[model samples]
Target: MSLRAYLHAIARCPSLEQLWETHTQRMAEYGFDRLIYGFTRYRTSTSLGDPEDFVILTNHSREYTDEFLHGGLYFHAPMVHWALAHDGACSWAVLHDMTRERAMTPEEERVVEFNRRMGVHAGYTVSFKSISNRSKGAIALTAKPGMSQGQVDAVWAEHGSDIQLMNEIAHLKILTLPYSTPSRALTPRQREALEWVGDGKTMQDIAVLMGLTSATVEKHLRLARDALAVETTAQAVLKASFANQMFVMDV
Candidate 1:
């Protein structure tokens, strides 16, 4: 597809699943068969916040992600560190230079070795621009196995501008979509109860609006807090709002 057509499609994507599906397919055309996109709104000086609160989308194999993400390898990844510190695209050649100079710490070197074992040899990482100091988003584009950094660079030279534009648009569109962790999605009832609470409704008021007993309404609010991993209903409302999961129109 032409760049213009792709950008239009991305802008019109109503759901995160559709956007991620099209994006992974589009990126694979450029020999980047594996992609991991991560965004966090709760970043702190010492951490990226809880992994459960992050928006993580990827097309990489389960084995790769299980280790890289679930095993805590991402914390020490060289490219991940680069993305945390800067914005815009970066070639993996810098990682190679670091390896040659023996500049990587032991933890970083271990991450590189794991990537090599997994055939994630060459790629690019795009760190998206953020207006808030506590927000960061980035995508790692891993070249197909056996492709060299030189070859990926050549492709970038010809089409990098369009690729970067598409990624940026995808990131922005994703932010507008309602997202909850796989195990933490609120039911329609739970969401409705939270919406009422957010509007400063009392339990009896929400019960009247939802046509449920006050006990049921309170139960829903409690479940919403549990789903969002917040201690209070107010915190649940805030977290849901941050995830775009509150007061969202049906898609």
Candidate 2:
């Protein structure tokens, strides 16, 4: 299907299942059979335990899905780790180049073996954090061999932004659904710090901007991270942006 047609189908989706169907249909049009869209909350915990949060939408074989989840493959998936470190969408070629020299852990090797068995030869992964300063996760699209790079790039370049936007919308919708986790509350100072961070300011820069000691700035950031249940200052910034928790003030 054409990109415009695929986007129209996505636009018509009224539920998560419909969104998955649209995405899978689009992927099949491009010659891919397996697709996995996942969200995780790893930044909040020291150990990558069972995702305290999730929003997986997939069209992969049930056997593979069952094996992946049963084996807890996410903890060792190199793609997941790489996606967590970068911003925006990335292709499989980029991932291959990035990890070429790094030795894969045993667990990571197991994930690779699982991928090989499942016929997933190449894929792209995109990540986003909450606007409320709370959580972060990723979405992945996989394809079998024989799919040309041009084909992949063309589709991604045309549809990538919409996919990211949809993921964010879906995330927010899921969060606000009945029985979802309560939203985290932030103090005025914490809110200010989060906004500055999203603006790409460093702690030192924020301290100078706020006319406060670096230590005091750090203290506020620490509190914000704790309240948001994030591990790093970067995660805190992303979560706040995703959750729309940061209040922008005119200087």
Candidate 3:
């Protein structure tokens, strides 16, 4: 597909799943068979916030992500560090250079070794620009197995600009879609209660609007807080709003 057509499709994606499906397929055409995109708004000076709060989408097999992500290997990943510090495309050759120079820390070396075992040797990492100091987003495009970094670099030299642009567009569209980890997800009733609270409604008022007793209204708000892992209803509203999960049209 043409670049223009791909961008248009992503811009109109009604849900995250559809957008991700379209993006992964398009990227595979460029020889990047595995893609992992991650975004976090809860970044701190020392950390990228909690893993549960991140927006992570990947086409990699569970065998890879299960350890890289769930096992916290991403924290020690060299490209992840580079992505956090830079705002553009970088070749994995940089990591190779670092290895040659013995500049990688022990933890980082372990991550590199792990990737090598996973057949994740060749790829490019694109670190997306962030407007907020506490937010970061990036995508890693891994080439098909047995493809050397030199071969991947050759493809990048020819079409790097178009590839980066498509990824940036896909990342922007992803941010507009509502996303919540399963544990953070709210039920329809919980969301409606929070929406009312956002509008400054009292418990009784929300109860009347939701056709429930004040006790049930309070119950929904309490459950919302638990789901969002917030201490109060106001915090839940803010968290949900940040994730674009509040007052959103059903998709």
Residues 1-251 of candidate 2: C-alpha lDDT, one tens digit per residue: 66567566666555556666666665665555576766554445465433433546677777887878656787678788776666567776654554586567778777877876777657677766645233466667776567754677777777667656655554455443211124456777888887888888988999999999889999999998887688999988766654446663332
Best by TM-score: 3
User: Which candidate's lDDT is highest?
Assistant: 3
Better of 1 and 2 by lDDT: 1
TM-score of 1: 0.96
Q: Model 3, 148-236: lDDT tens per residue?
A: 99999999999999999999999999988999999999999999999999999988899899999999999988999999988998899
Worst 10 residues of 3 by lDDT: 242-251
Error of 1 at 50 (Å): 1.2
Return whichever of 1 and 2 wins on TM-score. 1
Clashing pairs in 2: 130-242, 130-243, 131-240, 131-241, 131-242, 131-243, 131-244, 132-243, 133-239, 133-240
lDDT of each: 0.93, 0.66, 0.95
Global CA lDDT of candidate 1, please?
0.93
Q: What range of 10 consecutive residues in model 1 has the weakest lDDT sum? A: 242-251
List model 1 lDDT by residue over 27-107, tens digit each. Answer: 999999999999999899999998999999998899999999999999999999999999999999999999999999999
Candidate 1 pairs with clashing backbones: none
